[model samples]
Target: MSTLLPISAKTPAGRPRGDGAETAQGLTPAQMARRMAGLEGLVWLDSSRPGEGALSMLTALPCEVLAGRMDTDWQRVEEELEAGQKAGLAGGLFGWAGFDGRFVLGVFPHALVYDHDRRCWFDSGGLAARIPAVAAAAAGSVPRLDFSPQVRREDFLSQVRRAQELIAAGDIYQVNLAHSWQAAWPRGADALSAYQRLRRVSPAPHAAFLDLAGVTVLSASPELFLKMSGREIMTRPIKGTRPRFPGDPARDAASLSALLASEKERAELLMITDLERNDLGRVCEYGSVRVDGLWEVESFAQVFHLVSTVGGLLRPEVSHAAAFRACFPGGSITGAPKKRAMEIIQELEAAPRGLYTGAVGYFGFDGESRWSIAIRTAVREGERVTFHAGSGIVADSVPELEWEETLHKAAGLLAAWSLPR
Candidate 1:
């Protein structure tokens, strides 16, 4: 059995003097995660890329569990968050919201926070003493994962063609289409080990690993969906992708130049940027919303992406629920003219996207929050592990190329699963 320790308000022993922060001596975030693996409600919002604000956060033994199924749940979650703030919990609330508005949230009283800026770990409670012993335990080898796509290639290409038809007919300008892959859970491999492998291969700015009661989430997403600090709100959306070629510098540079010069890619990013601006405008102070960054290329392990940043100052009267409701499913994943695109997607796709393209992050008791666009993510439930990849389809998109783009976007995840392209 794993140890569950409550956070001590007073600094515990073994902590360094003069601020109670301890430099990481024995356990890496992965090791700490392994120490608490299988603990219900364990949430790790891991910044696998260091020097990006918070290094990582580990919390388990939730004091309050919040869940909802319908759209109305947003209001309930907001209310619960406000109440949690009033109750003065030691730590924050963390969880994910699905694409369909279904969500599972948790408020933890104990936590282990690692601050990259400080180069130290803040132990909210007493779990540190129990972590180092388990750090040295060797992880089990990951076995081959025989993943099968839920959508056939021919069917996906046909769906892409249909979406192009819709664009041509003026039903929608752009739509994001996705398909899932599933594999039987290997008997000896655990979620922690898989996540460790994933982070090693695809270190991302917004990576995370979550172990809920019966569900496990492993994410290496590089897109930021929403961030709220005080009355300020911001979002970064990614729209274009080009695979990286590390062995060939000239090819890699050519890929970067090509991505920057593609009009189609620029158009795709612009549409989503506009959509995000509109969403923020709904709850933001008038004239405060602005595009902070546009058409910037961010390179990741497997690919390079065109990213844009939009932000605004929130209206004084806007509540957290209202802010979230205005922009629940991010525009980048939903496409331009959000509602209509989502309708088209629902009509075309085979299965519900339970967590893919959703938001995964935390709402702090301090009234701050950060969420990532849930791409490059996998979910483990019972004996099955499932994941999905998506691409934005436009009028000029070729069905074959769009299908290949999804595979490119899924390269890191596929590699983590130890599968070939």
Candidate 2:
């Protein structure tokens, strides 16, 4: 594992020093992100929703790129982050960690951080100076995408049945099964424009647009995987889901009620919640881990999810990497007995998940970090675009209904590309 040499002097905790002329100039984060499109190493951590204490961040021109495809590589990244923090380096590391240990992270010297609550942009690097020129440039059109499922309906159903069989044999209590879609990246469409369209239809609190060396990630994930502020850490896992009825209030309310009342839904969420608690216990101080919230319903533009919050204070000797290793690839996305569930997922799914169900976020040099579970996310590479949606298959899971649920979860991504469900 390579280490980051100390860069600039440290600023205050949680607050990076800006150029003192911070202003939005009446532009939204989305607009600013559009201006920054096509820039390599661009990372925009967007909070599409308002007033959640979440800040949108944009930064480019990485001083060092930290990328890896194995667990050892991830450990190196964690070590680099911890070393940077101890050395009092200014700035942060931003990028995504793919399912398993594959990741592409970068260390930036400055950034443009937007405070949603205050409705303004703070320029840490002098990079904010170019925003005016880019904003004045013409925004390009988004091309239409024709996406087709990589997994046939019959195959998906069979996979679900296999998962159920495993549960029957006590191999696992639950497993998350997924299918993917692929589309040719059209001539004129760009990652940022597609992300803009996606946010328009399905804005989320943990959304992001990350343009790396060879890959671009457009995510509108609603699940928080991990958050670290000093010694305190938290994880919010989403397990159960119900699609929303956009035009019919009565139908939507009924759907929400049914999700809340379903025994299967409740059981699914409880299993993951317990799994998260156990995961946290590994890195947190003894007796400090606890469930902050359980079996709560959170409504998004396209679906209603049963979410739970588990948190604890980290052990004094625990490093950020240690904390993440204890809880990577969140339990909500995998299932109970995570290792076995992932093994079954690999055996049954059509292809590797790549960035889907992975995590996207940042690790500040100040020891603060935040990451979101990469569901409802798309990855664009060269002329190809790929995304996946999944459902938790419990013992009583019906293959047909589970397939339907995957479609419901995929509705937002498809709608973003102007494709019919």
Candidate 3:
């Protein structure tokens, strides 16, 4: 079992930090690793920053990192995870494994944790002692960077048309296609700062900053891939998008209203929503899977999305790994008839999606977890940063319109990277 410790009212980073609306501040995992030395496998999920919303942080290091391929026996992986949890693993596990481990399987971290929501910290041992300094440290500033689209507008349009042809042939109903934008940052670039700027412009409920070893992922996604509490599980998938007009209030309202009324967009969202229901039904208890919400338009900094919620009750015998595996690479991003859509995507897309379509969040030791669909996210390595944006394609979708939708989605992250510091 883990221990929950209380932190004194001492201010961190010179700010009067209390349990109020003050922005929660903490070091990025990379920043913490640099300062703490010997912290290679550290994992920290910080939401203490105000406006960033939640004031909770979960931090730890893995006793060992686990790796598996998409073809790896999921049953076995679930067994390992069950054993670890049964052993009373201390900290929650965090990961961004590709759609399947065909790319990589994320590892679980074990150590001290600070649960701001609970007003206490947890660790199996003395790891909780280090939370203070890590929380108190200041975040570095983001350096100015430049990004170039890997897929030119014309090329993206051509791909959209190709997808429509596939849909016309009755090959697939919808397929989500994406393009990448990349930049190279010199050492000392601040990913956390970039994430903060993104949140300021487009606050998302699923915003996350993940530092996995040397790689850091900054996301401002508005979609929830999965959320678990005991046997209840839910997924909120977003299928349609419309850019938010900032200059005119009347136009913005009309644009949102139009998006809400778009039959094509509603068709796109419903297809994915039904696909999600099927995916959830696989692992959920019999008759437990159902659509909770549908055709709801939610606004964000960059765009508005038609969102829906699908939920189910997990079987008593189902494991967390099983519940998540059934919904890997969220349906919102993959499109309807999940497998066929992925096949078309793999055939037409110029590059591997890597973590863009993956999920990020913590698999807690206490049988609860929260994961955000990894969209509107940037991945940073030493000096290079890459992120992607995509749109769903249905038979009636116009090539040029779908192309523009992707650009609208990419706008905020591009601004975050290109904006002058």
Candidate 4:
């Protein structure tokens, strides 16, 4: 644990603060990670407190890479990792994982960790000592980005009607239907600047920005998929949503109130909570899985959400990999009666979700992990940038209202990039 002392020397009027006193070049940790070599990375936990937020930048990779395309490969990695005589690995591993990737891509990086309380950088390795003299990455003026839908509005509405019919037939209680909106990636689009704008416009606790290879993931998600510390595993699933209007406190409060009071929304949330509890039960000790909170209304930059926390103690025989596999592609996004809902979603949704509904976070070597449901995210590859948003459709859901909800959820991101809704 090597700590860098805070630079407190004050500067003259209008001058920049001394090193260590100033925050890193307004770069979203992921942008900072990309400048480094090997498998270096960053994990930033969106927090409200100015200095209390968690941010980690990895500057060194322990090895090249270890990617697995299937569950068995990951399971084998878990077994081999646990069997390794690496003592501090108990702290965990650091990297990223996705919901639809054929492979779970990851790496072990030496990191520089910082938070508000600490107020200084702590490096697990000597990497941070060599801070670079890089110019501030400029995003210039925010440009309006327009999006085209993969699934037409009428088509999405028809899909919603079909889902309701399925519910009527007792095939499933609810299903999540989504549409991908795509736009041409602006030439030299600075994802870091986009993320900063996103934070300013729609800050969220689970916001993340990652540039894995050339595929950049920009997220301002307000939902937590899973978090584990030692034997305790926790998940906060978000199911219901209502958008917040800019500068309209009265309307926002009413929206929040409506979301909380709606029986349909409550029912939707409870169904997912039950699904999560069951998911946790698969890897947790018998009778240990429980719903810690139900139907809690959390307000965010863009919307109000009905969130619930489900937690459990991991069975001694269950590895973290097992627990994650059993619970992921989180039930909230997939809907109730998970497998059947997914089948319906696949059949109806125009395309595979790819990385949109994935999970992103670091699994520390200390047996601690935190990942967010990759909602409210943008994926940029080459000349294209795409975003996806969806709403859970229940028997009582109106197709038009559900379609509008997706727009509401995407409003902040669109606004951050100056895109039309």
Candidate 5:
């Protein structure tokens, strides 16, 4: 929507081959595997030609689905659908698209859609049996890394102070702060292997490295941006953050617990809850907006987080894109008074935030979905890889500690590149 780069795994044809390796060409993975095989992993589907959805290219296959009709309000369409199931969503999207439209959708079941208990995935490429085929192509190829680093730390802080001054004058309650990172790489080694390497050295339950258009968003985040079901919209914005135990268990616990009890953290969390509720209220049924849950803690390999879940029923008039537009680039990742915080972030954080602080997930027709904020992550392009991480800054925020928090946040990706997590 911002005239940004494409967000799909499929490589475009006629686009000059960097390597002679034949880029796989056909209908998307799901369309090709219409029968006998099950689709899996973070299935991503988008158009080579922008804006329009794929029609005849898909729907040639049979499946269950849910979707957000471009013309229909999202709340009305996805009344009770799971956020990730793509079959139903594919059907819904194509069904709404009718006979001729260029809209191409992606269907992803799960990494373990075929076998959830086992950590292994069913690579349609026969990654198990024919690993050599795809593996052989691995050479000097690379992946592009992207981010929005904090521009001038002091200048950014000055903007935060300005916001605080405005707050003192009574403009708003809070604002979110952030930084970004980005890089690009050529494909060589296996992406899965890289991920496995990370798991081996630094185990994490919620880390992910999703690729779209050769741009991989590698992350080790414990934060869930939002999940939707039927009329219920649930978003858990992680507010306060603290790194994993750095030798001193007592200090780590104290740090986490202090965040739990800190007035600044509590206020920060509340502002997001309010922002989320308002965002949901846009598409939700008039009376459906409500905070079903409150402040709670979710633990991860590197940090502990303060989170809260809020839910609401969608009104019949909202469309899926409408819902996204109502809440794009997550408020928690941004700041309160969302727009203003974003403006300040652009000025403070040096680089442009490609997809670092952005949300990633599957948009389906079945009405079900789950998206996570890309934090604790790294980006890789060619031989170069980098990680981006940052913390919120309020009048009470300590710059030194905030800087430490960013390093802590970046630990996972940095670790991927043989650096710190």
Candidate 6:
């Protein structure tokens, strides 16, 4: 996989130029592998637990880094959405040489450094340009993991019930619950193929995978982290969810409407919104936190969702890292009453989320950038493939409905697996 992506250093240095957003290249699996040749990078895929230190540890790695960012020009995004545009402008954040603080990217669909001569990927020692690929990993490797699948579901849920008890005793309104899957893949399978196949079933606005350090951060995320272009930074956190029906659209729409109107759904959305507002408040100029849109229901192939967009202006000197730090592990994917919910979810769920609910993206070393929450992804190593799907289980959340929601989230990966639909 690393051979195709040749990381070739420029013989003569010139000012790095910017390229606008590039769509995922419709290439074959072999093509993707060939692209990962000789390159050095450190990729980190982590669920949004602010305390976890993965992002911080990633930035401090001893290698050139490129991060994806979308917190730029929120105004332009609206225009594009209203106009029915297929995409928007984006860039890469890089840290190189003596220019340690900035990076450059021109909205390429996928970026990488290839061997100068072979035009293939460069993995060995050599100076090369930096690039970002919405999809990446050695031939078949995936993010490293320390999985605990034997945990009992009942025990996990009991922990969550305990947390709910705690929330009731406090002023917290809602929380999101989750489970994770963890394993390691070293040049094992094709991630982009999996992503393209997954999109056929569950397409989302935000998705990415990073191969950095010694691990590959795999993600098929559905949530947006933080996006920055110039002074504008925006986050669209997905809070409420309903499962998809295999039978009819009318029935699905009805279910979706119920989700849209449900009190539990609204509470979950509000919890994340409040969390995001606080995050933005950290770096945003005072009075910049605003809910541009809220409780907007968007439909995927398998389900309906209540998603909200919140944003703020970055303080003139504030760095993108600070903005993300304020709202790591996006509020939507994580249960509300944030900290307590995570504790409950972790304790209740049987599997480790690994890169499941974690953020996958690039940050701009050149200017501003964006990050996407990893969800609906499948991990492949050797002959085995593992994929996960989950939903927020609130007080009113039905066990059946929540169970079905997990199926809905898994629809994309299942379809990607080519199981009989």
Top candidate on lDDT is 2
State every prediction's TM-score relative to the real structure. 0.91, 0.92, 0.85, 0.85, 0.66, 0.64
Using lDDT as the measure, name the better of candidate 3 and candidate 4: 3
Which one wins on TM-score? 2
Which candidate order results from sorting by TM-score in descending order?
A: 2, 1, 4, 3, 5, 6
Q: What C-alpha lDDT values do all the predictions have?
A: 0.82, 0.83, 0.71, 0.70, 0.50, 0.50
The window of 10 residues in a row where model 4 has the poorest summed lDDT is 1-10
Candidate 5, residues 1-421, lDDT tens digits: the string is 1111121121222233222112223223322222212212222221211122211111122133343333444443344233433323222222212111111223322111121232112222112221111323222212223433445566555655665675566555565555544444434545544544454445433444444323444555566676665555777788888777868889888978887788888888888889988888878888788887677886666677788888888776665645654676677877777777777666555566555665555444445445666666565555555556667766677666676676677665545544222
Looking at model 4, residue 249 earns an lDDT score of: 78
lDDT of 2 at 385: 92
lDDT of 6 by residue, 1-421 (tens): 1112222332123433212012113322224433433334433222212222112112212323333333443233233222321232222332210001112221222333322223233221112223234334444432233333333456545645654575667634565555443334335445544444444445455534444433433455657777776678999888777776759878876887788788887877877888888878878899988999999887666667888899889998776655654566666766655666666556556655554565556554334456776566654445444556666756555555554566567556555444242
lDDT of 2 by residue, 122-232 (tens): 655445644444443466676578999999999999999989899999999999999999999987676677888888889998999888878989899999999998889
Clashes per candidate (backbone, < 3 Å): 1, 0, 8, 13, 73, 89
lDDT (Cα, tens digit) per residue for candidate 1, span 1-421: 0112222333455453322123333456776777666466779999898755655888787877878864766666777778766875456668888898788888776568766676556665454533443434467776568889899999999999999999989999999999999999977676788888899999998999988656788999999999888789999999998889989999999999999999999999999999999999999999999999999999998899999999999999886556876798999999778999999989999899999999898877666778999999999988899999999999999888888889988888888875655
User: Where does candidate 2 stray beyond 4 Å?
Assistant: 1-25, 125-132, 419-421
Pairs clashing in candidate 1?
7-125
Q: What are the runs in model 4 whose C-alpha is more than 4 Å off?
A: 1-62, 76-85, 89-92, 133-144, 419-421
**Whole-model alpha-carbon lDDT for candidate 1:** 0.82
The TM-score obtained by model 4 is 0.85
Between candidates 1 and 2, the TM-score winner = 2
Q: What's the lDDT for residue 82 in model 6?
A: 24
